[model samples]
Target: MTASNPASVVPSIHDRFAVVRERIRSTCVAAGRDLASVILTAVSKTQPDEALEAALATGQRVFGENRVQEAQAHWADRRAAFPDLELRLIGPLQTNKAVEAVQLFDVIETLDREKLAAALAAAMQKTGRRPRILVQVNTGAEPQKAGVLPDDADALIASARDGHGLTVEGLMCIPPADEAPEPHFKLLAEIAARNGLSVLSMGMSGDYEAAISCGATHVRVGSALFGERISPLKPS
Candidate 1:
């Protein structure tokens, strides 16, 4: 499809949201759970502003972005028009960018290491932002991934809570693409329960249903909502 084509040919944001919401509803129903308990975070990294406008018009208040720079550029101004919007940083964070991340996001879902934890704590002290945080656990133990290993998650969470004075609200994870995600989701849920944390930010578009069934409280959905991201949009 070409850009010149009428917008009618493109799936309306309402249509996409309805489809995804229905899927979430069905999944929750199947699990004997309340739908309101789940938070549907539209992953908006690399998505164009027009697409974001469409989603905002459809009342999508929660969104996830994969990069600090991109999110700062894309949302800095647009947020003025949607004061109630909530943005979550869902990507791996660098120690150097902790202050910016603390300022730019309402939640940070990729808290994975001590260095990063310390940086974020210092940043929070400097900025007084203190966005809610989640410890990303590398449940699959993939060397290339950016989460704390499963064995280390408990200690990291404790440090973030007791040492750094950061609010470790929950746990997040990205299971290996080739593996069944239920086990990982289940593990995250267990970890959260043991630590008295309430949020379980697991699941993507492909495995969200299973994640929900296994007790995911937040699902980061991108492609299913906005379609595959086009080439990066110039930050507006």
Candidate 2:
């Protein structure tokens, strides 16, 4: 689906959503996976409130954010009005903001290290809201990335599940941008299988089809839904 102008008046959110849903449907059909099994997490990071409202108008309740503060600012008051909105934190989380993260997000997808895990556990206890976690795996072993190294996934998942009393439901990954992501996606699926994990939050706007074929349960897409982001928010 072609994206409308970001500079000009934006296209209807329902139109964009239809395009994305069609893509997802085609991908699922090609992969021989049930359409009901895959989830489309509209990556709404850096998008304005109007975009969110348009999405809501189209019956899109699930959204992904890259920053806690931005999401909190945007959705704090709106959540009450739209009670079913599901906010998934698809960005790296700072340990210091664990409490705020727990308060703001429904699913925390970037739990990669022990320090963050401990902080989140405490925050969940204080808030009495246990957000489902997906341990991020640095499948490419990129030093600059925010996920745990592939080798360390097992131990961290175990720690988050057993020691920290957190519900570690699955694994997430962002493959190296320049390389083919199929291997990395397959590796994550294998890791999740070994750990008895179900959710695989991999893929983005560019490679979601490949990810679904590799068993990605959730695909985070932005540009395909909202056009190119207006601002390049730094990775949090």
Q: What are the models' TM-scores?
A: 0.94, 0.93
Regions of candidate 1 where Cα sits further than 4 Å from its true position = 1-11, 231-236
For model 2, how many clashes?
0
Q: How would you encode candidate 1's per-residue C-alpha lDDT over 1-236 as one tens digit per residue? A: 56323374235666999899999999999999999999999998987667877788778999999999999888999888889999999999999999999998999999999999999999999998979999999999999999999888999999999999899999999999998888888888888898999999999999999999999899999989887766855799
Poorest stretch of ten by lDDT in candidate 1: 2-11
Error of 1 at 59 (Å): 0.5
Candidate 1, number of clashes = 0
Q: What lDDT score belongs to each candidate, Candidate 1 first?
A: 0.90, 0.90
